[model samples]
Target: MADTEKTAIAAHLYVALRRVANRVIDIEWMAQNEEYARAIIKFAVEQGNEELARQALRYQALLDGEPAPREASARAEATPPSADTVKKRYIGTLR
Candidate 1:
């Protein structure tokens, strides 16, 4: 990858990892869409974006109760509020 593209990917992953670590920027969003993050990480890694992959790894470290670089700090309610907790349920008609 070119330097410019790598830089862009690095910055994007940095902010993403920072937000994931903080857990206050977008809790529901992240919790709901880790697939997107994983996809980006995979692409970045495939493209030889070490910095980007490092950023991705930092989030895993944070989840593992290990120290991770910080930037800011998901800093939600609704029974099964977010889709993440959604489960199949029967629906009843109301008058």
Candidate 2:
């Protein structure tokens, strides 16, 4: 990649990392920006974060109007929800 492109990707990766720290994943960004999604997947792999990589792949598939792979979908289904998601799901009921 050109230096400018690399810089842009780096900047976007930082934003993506920040979102991850905030427990937020912008699937919309991943779906719309192929380079950003690739960057996230590459970063996740380099960092040995399989879950994040899988999520990026899934988001890419969804945004590209393709069904996720059956095995990946099954594994994703088996994965437990994040604590934040659980809280959000039950918060209204607790009111």
Leading candidate by lDDT: 2
User: Which residue segments of model 1 deviate by more than 4 Å?
Assistant: 1-31, 63-95
lDDT of each: 0.46, 0.52
> How well is each residue in 1-95 modelled by candidate 1, as lDDT tens digits?
12323343345665654554432233334333556545555554554455556665655454444665543322334233443333223235333
Global fold similarity of model 1 (TM-score) = 0.33
**Tens-digit per-residue lDDT, 29-71, candidate 2:** 6545667667666665455455555544554454456764333
**Candidate 1, residue 16: CA error in Å?**
10
Off-target runs (Cα >4 Å) in candidate 2 are 1-27, 60-66, 70-95
Best by TM-score: 2
- In angstroms, give how far residue 79 of model 1 lies from its true place: 45
| TM-score of every candidate relative to the true structure | 0.33, 0.36
lDDT computed for candidate 2: 0.52
